[model samples]
Target: MDPERFQKNAMYVETPEVFDAEKNFDDDGRIKRTGTLTTASAHIITAVIGSGVLSLAWAIAQLGWVAGPAVLLAFSFITYFTSTLLADCYRTPDPVHGKRNYTYSDAVESVLGGNKVKLCGLAQYINLVGVTIGYTITASISMVAVKKSDCFHKHGHQAKCSTSNNPYMILFACMQIVLCQIPNFSKLWWLSILAAVMSFAYSTIGLGLSIAKIAEGAPVRTTLTGVQVGVDVSASDKVWRTFQAIGNIAFAYAYSNVLIEIQDTLKSSPPENKVMKKSSLIGILTTTLFYVLCGCLGYAAFGNDAPGNFLTGFGFYEPFWLIDIANICIAVHLVGAYQVFCQPIFGFVEKWSKEKWSNSEFINAEHEVKLPLCGIYSVNFFRLVWRTAYVIVTAVLAMLFPFFNDFLGLIGSVSFWPLTVYFPIEMYIKQSNMKKFSFTWTWLKILIWVCLIVSLIAAAGSIQGLVQDLRKYKPFQAEQ
Candidate 1:
């Protein structure tokens, strides 16, 4: 998009749509909301079921049949329950007929004010940045998978189809740099819907392949306790992997960071909280079911040796076309997702720069440039330089550490507790005026502490895993 349209279509991915007077304003004097339960649920599922799903099979493999499903269920319930509280916080002082909180940080500022607002902003921006990096890594993996699939199909099953991920990572980063020029690359509302569809496509394809593998006669070994310590892994590695698995699950359900953003899109007539609660339930259930099936079936097929990324990690070698299609879907999804996730970071930094150097022509000036296809768009020197630099940093990081499972787990563990748990719990209690020391309040406190501990342990595990991976591979030299 050119500068004119970029400024016109968006300041962020959730670009405002100008509606006529006939459209209901939802009593907030803002543009009319068209979001219904279906759209809301779609958004939730899209945000929740990202590349994190790629790790679930490995995550489940870390914690066997008994613990894996149980963990997923527990997370589903916790996420849903906390989400209802958060949905209510979308409107301050009242769940209905109250002041609107347009963003998560807005809700935090309105209900639980003070330094927590800064905390919320920090966590959100960091998570968004981390998400973009993760996407960079994930997209590269999928592209590499497409290539590897071809190599395996052309060669033989036993042939070494090994390769590095740096080229693909650079290619993906270059694509993102181009896409980033179009400020509203994702257009959140529509991308959410598209993401949900794409996620379903690839997830179903993966699940189908796993099921097909399991049906092939030979028995695969599985144990109630997952990967054994002595036989499969060292005891220390087991402990760390178990924690890392928890992080992976947390990442899969890490949608709370954007819950208020989705909730803000809902029509207020049905009570946004009511619709949001229902949507959260539906989304989590659907996502969890998909997750359970994928993780369980993938584990059933490969057992102890389940790959961190089943598609790209060389779990299946045949049916090259199907594999290529599934991976292509993932690549497309990540391209959109990366833009959506990174938009906030872009907005934040640009806003800060404009404010800090308000007098600089280089940072403030815009020149109109016409493109044949996208039409005339304004080009800002600062924006071009900053965005390009940002993409470079993320790409360099992805190249330096292409450890998929560990990197994803670290991102999840870092953002899960503060952004997802602590903020929502605090805002809910404060907004509802729930009495201190009450049973519910006490339980919420316990939930906060528990989740915080989990985040810490998960972070440790992920860091350890990254360290171990680094010993095996050099920076920018990551290989399958």
Candidate 2:
């Protein structure tokens, strides 16, 4: 069997005997049509909005109101543009052939060939794993906030929470182990929808609370440089801070990792690019609206004192009930967010398993698994263990490197150029067969280069920030 032909034919089968979306069934024996415009929009929204939103205020505070939202809107357009390029690459050979690209790696293999597939796979898993670790850190911190709120009521202590994040991280790992066992991407639709709602809910609440506090005469938070608004700061310090802010904004919109996979879930009849374009537009606009509102209001409310996480930071000043509600929303949403991102990682592992062991028990014939009454889900045995182990490993990493903000910036910077900017534009240029030096082609090259340089600088700054923060506070040590 020719490897190139196998790669193409694997996803784009013309014959029903090979693969068909309609023929795919879920655990409940229902045809698994995971991609509807609405559901796909929800999943995209869920993927885009994560713990990153919590830092938008800090990003804005660093750049101030004007440049902050400006950077955000710029990145939104860039992410949407690149993601559409990805969605367009979802199928190959003309509309009649209608072969689908089911994963980002598959799309890369189809357009860039098998050699580049591994590169895509590597960047993708790193991004996904980094995201999973970020979410674990989020869940644990949110849990710690909730616990500390209870402690505040019990003992009236106002300092940092006495509880460590490790226990809650472990608890979150357990939740992911169960959610990750859902067996197929199609099974996670409701979870995605719920996660979307939770994202909106917390964002809205955070914004509303900020507005209320500002109305009550809360002072604007000061800059990290210890200067009040309008006070002079060094140009070099301001420039570096703005650069870091760009990364935080970029990280907030880092959903390119799962764009292809989400499009794969769409119903096949109408053509995916059409639905995906609409979904991307809706998702980005929705998230952008929330981001602008949350970031602006949060900066206004807290000024330079804004916490990296809006809800967590504002909780110190806001009511406990509101704080608990917001954190709980975060905790619940990360559960589903973890599942959304982990599905691709799970698929990759299963693919490797099947290739290495053709008779592996994990690869489902139709991506379906039935639940038994034995209190154990009837997923493939190997899959259950593999996924469980994956979550456990991420949880441990979260324990070891619990620097959520810095680590998220690092992942975003590392992934933003490759997944979001580089591949999409390159594939678009190649797939579209755009002539060299043409207006659009020239601009695409310029965009790619600019993004690469900016991302590299941001990645370096993130690493530097992580090292400095680590020196001041060792991992696994209780926050003082």
Candidate 3:
């Protein structure tokens, strides 16, 4: 088959079956379907949950409870409106005819052509890199929390502290990559189910404990005072800021690609199954409820001065068992995120290299050309180096920036804005034909403008937060 033509044809098809098969397996030895709506919903929920849950209260507390819900509502509306717009655009393009599978880059290319697409791609690449870094940082923090807990301490606390470097982190990352390399969708589906269960169990237990502590009259510290202090913003300003911060926090919930992938999976399922929409609704509702409960309980228990250390505040202090459980759950969640992040990079690289190395024409054409001796030519070497580097870099970053919510919100808001809000409205404008713009369309345009403006402001806030964090960096400080 012609390489170009084959590539074009494959764009509409689901990801190669081999890749799907490799990632689907449960801890309990069950196989699940990856392309189904249920799995898609799970992916969306898991992606949103990540390590952000740990610091959500801290962020929300900055604005207080009243402002926090407003922020949440605004972001929720933005997500729903923008997503539906994008989904409509996706539906406009016949899934089978043109390139059915559309990425952020594809959407950009369709609207603005090559130059703008390149810019968008760069932004996406940075966002992905930042996300990977954030994931690793969260994983490392979780690992340290587990190590410092009474469970590990009782085993040999002094010795464990002396050898603080976590080998299990590396081992887990490797295991995740290996699992993802498997090419069976059914297996990947099953694994997601187990992951979903583990995630739920961990979150539920932790949340329940947090709520119990709050009910027992735990004192909550107020980080921001309502009275204006010198250079700091007034309480009212802070409240508005918190409302803006909701838009940032809402970025965690933006998982448009996962939704599209899930939609693709459902295409093959029975038409009678309303699983995709139902699962999405269920997942979002479940996650939102959890978020509100955790946020309220955490604030009530730990206040604004919650410790940076895992499971320390929120009344989990001194309970080695609880800490250990939280740590393990967090680590497992990180592994899940790593799998999701790494899959696309792996697929892209694999496809890019296959043609150059495996094609007969390329081989024959290159026969007389001299290849560099030191450069990478062997796929085995590439895989080894790539996997090793991925783990090491991720681990180091995770340790350095353990404040997962800050990083997740910053990166997610910036990157997701264009994909979830701007591009969709742009596509709608380009494709829609109206003799006169209706009131609804006018309202949508206004909403889109608001999203774009708020997105920029939110991105600025997150960037400012990140900068402040970087300025306060202390080396080798123990996880608080």
Candidate 4:
């Protein structure tokens, strides 16, 4: 195929109209007014920092403290380099029109055309949905766990439970889907900012309380290796444990699509490439520092046996009032994440069924108004039903297999690795036409292979964990 024709075809590959405002350039080669750099960057950061940070210590504990930071840094380097390459491919000129524009799948199709691209695209979509669901379910459980703990229930009477069927979690997920349906990307940008701020604040406060507890001379346990204060797993299991750590790191760094979406959200000349590059750097650095601090402080304060959710775990030892406040904050923050995850899926479904259902007069016309200013929209009854079905499916899965962390790990291991590592380099080489791989490219390929291997190992471990939990699974139980 002629390179130009190939590029044009790739450019038009599944480019959704909803995203056109952000991705389409005007006569002057600038994106139409959609959102600002700050707004776009905030969304990127929010998308990246989900439940993975909370569980860093658990994974790192298996690898020991000395190895934890090193692993994190390595993952960060790999993620940043590969992400940059993908960004470069995205900026390549369109083959047909001689214009430079790209979509997430465009990059993939450029390298591995035909069935490979389709398979990868399908996997990417599934992974995105899976992670979103994973985050939603985990966040819901965390919210309810916090609420029922001594923290949120200080008053004798519980807040009237919103929805009884699947607990308030279903209700929470529904609310998020509704919010995401709002059509205004700009408005959604502000919401993303709020969510990102709340996440950082909640995590910071929780970490602070844990640190204060440690400073007050709380009981501290040294590692089995006799390290005064650090993570330690048995030496015999070091390699396997390191593999686990790599999986955790990959999970933490697996938001490249989110970053790409954010980049596409910008409305500037050539979309201000620096904005994304800088934002990603800031996001990764902030996230890594936060995780390391939280992990170290949490371990110092409560040791390895600390509650899986550090906030709830710390609440058991702190003042009842502090715990209550923390619970409320955590719940709110989690709700925000649920909203972010649900929005894209809602958009995808809405677009998928638009032709059949959107023009039907019987359908509520008010639902079709693309309210870009507010980033909110109404969905027809069918869309609502579809979303509800998704919620039900996810909730049933969560209930059937209530091993939260392991389930999350499994989702992360299976989906995140292919989406993040395997696909990016392939896209880059094919799209950019790098006939001879540079040293940097060669290193990245090696790193991606390593990540792929680690993902498989982690998937196996997570499956094992899930099986063990299922053998002893029980319905929701309040933390003792």
Clash tally, candidates in order:
4, 8, 20, 12
Off by over 4 Å in 3: 1-34, 89-92, 95-99, 102-104, 107-116, 151-169, 183-187, 221-244, 269-276, 307-315, 353-392, 396-405, 432-436, 475-480
Top-down lDDT ranking? 1, 2, 4, 3
How many backbone clashes are present in model 1? 4
> What are the models' TM-scores?
0.88, 0.88, 0.75, 0.79
TM-score of 3: 0.75
lDDT score, candidate 1, position 226: 94
* Greater-TM-score candidate between 2 and 4: 2
lDDT per residue, candidate 1, 322-373, as tens digits?
A: 9898888888788767766676667667777888997888887767676666
Any runs in candidate 4 off by more than 4 Å, and if so which?
Answer: 1-33, 94-103, 151-165, 184-186, 223-245, 314-316, 354-385, 475-480
- lDDT per residue (tens digit) for residues 1-480 in model 2: 333333322221121234333355432233445479999999988998986787788778887766777788989999999988888888874422446677888888878885677887888889898898989988888888877776676667565557788989999998888778676586688899999999988887888888888898955644433323345446655566666777788888999899988887877757778899999999999999998988878788778656778666544544778778888988999998988899998888887777888654345322223334433233356776788899999998889888865778888888899999988888888788889999999999999999999898888777767777778877668744
Q: What is the C-alpha lDDT of each candidate?
A: 0.80, 0.78, 0.56, 0.60
| Candidate 1 displacement at residue 297 in angstroms | 1.1
Positional deviation of residue 153's Cα in model 3 after best superposition, in angstroms: 8.2
Pick the winner on TM-score between candidates 1 and 4. 1
Best by lDDT: 1
